[model samples]
Target: MADKQNVVSVSDRIPALKEQRKKRANRRLIFYLSIFFILIGIVVYFQSPLSHVQQIQVEGNYTGETREIIDQSALVSGESIWSQSLGSAKERVEQIPYIEEATIERSPDNITHYCPRTDRTAYLHNNDQFIPVYGNGKLMEEQSLDTYPSDAPIIFNWQNEELLEAFFVELDKLGSGMINHISEIHPSDDDPTLLRLFMNDGIEVETTIENFASYMAPYPTVARQISEPSDGILHMKMSPYFEAFNPEEYAGRFMKSTLIRVMVG
Candidate 1:
């Protein structure tokens, strides 16, 4: 009975030792696997070309100051992309006054992208004062009429915000050369949707806001066809056509009509 009991106790001890050995072997396998994966990650990080930035690309910059924006980004080539903070770089690029918004992106092809949108500027004329208009016709700093440049059209008595936004949208569609010929823009008193455009060549245009771009796009071609020193109203509301008028006679009629209306009233 004593010999049988001894054998049972020894058998139980043998199984416990095997279990302990198996547990140790599993632990060793897990530790080795962890080390192996960590080494592989390190090797890939150092050896892969994607880990470094090789090129910097800029887009959506309207001022043509791409180099300035890239310099401001502070993203140096050959730098480790893993260590780059894209958020911080984007913030720096947006510091430029003309840039309205900026976005940054990185790719595994070793490229860093910096995109910036510039604010659109226009001039608003109130009497003798010229105010700078930013995005969506929001007025900025005011300047004297004498100092205002002819680069942008001067808006006259345009107080409606919605109409101003639509006007800018249409104006932006026209090319810079076409826009340069426009000297002043006024909201028509007769119709809120109609706008009166005064051209640099002393020609006037009457067009609606909805199709302003389509009408204005062909203005340069139309102006060239007319006789030199031409001064008249080009009605572009429905059908596009030009009407010749004697400036002196028109002015006299205007004054006389104004006086007669005032006296009658």
Candidate 2:
């Protein structure tokens, strides 16, 4: 009777072990199926357009047309954000004239940000049109003079582009008050190295291109010494002098006369 009872206990233990093994197998199958489904979901999300770039936001652009800059970037909607090289994109965008620097960034919401920086130093007047000139003296797009009325000085007939660039570099050093006083700058018909400046206060200045800023620095102080509605020729080519004109007597002879060549500096 003892041996029979022992045999029955051993048989029951075997069935219990089998049941535990089956439960483990079922759990493992469920876990593996769950993992497989999650992997499929990840793959689907990556393959769909959800992971691609949908929009581009531009900022910090002043001279460049925002739409034109974006077009030049070569970054289009539906491009894979993960694969697109942001460094290369920035390089392409900076290639546009007047764009001194550029920065690019991406967001998780399928959007890209492009920021461009530039310094609009001056404008060149050619054929009755105004072209934007950057601090580096590179010419940007041209627009009608009427469309863009500029307080910046207008450069005229500067055939030597190299010299013009250098002149602009020097001009940028002057303060805004002095810069605003200048209305027109033209290369002297007598000497290309010399320039004639027409001031908004009706004073004409003649100086070498190299000495433009220094010679014109004291113009405001000198101008105040004269009476109101002053009209004169401030010659700075050789020595600082002012030739005042009697509005009635020298009305037409202003440019030809050296009558009141009084030394000011």
Number of the top candidate by lDDT?
2
lDDT of 2 by residue, 168-191 (tens): 777866666788888888886657
Residue 244 deviation, candidate 2, in Å? 3.5
Extract clashing residue pairs from model 1.
none
lDDT of 1 by residue, 145-254 (tens): 55766777888888788888888777767656677888888886657787878889887777878978887877877766666555566766445666656556555221
Alpha carbon lDDT at 178, candidate 2 = 83
Which portions of model 1 show Cα errors greater than 4 Å?
Answer: 1-101, 106-113, 116-121, 126-146, 246-265
Off by over 4 Å in 2: 1-42, 110-116, 142-148, 175-177, 214-218, 235-241, 245-257
Q: Report lDDT (CA) for all predictions.
A: 0.70, 0.73
Clashes of each: 0, 0
Judged by whole-model lDDT over C-alpha atoms, candidate 1 comes out at: 0.70
- lDDT score for candidate 2 against the true structure: 0.73
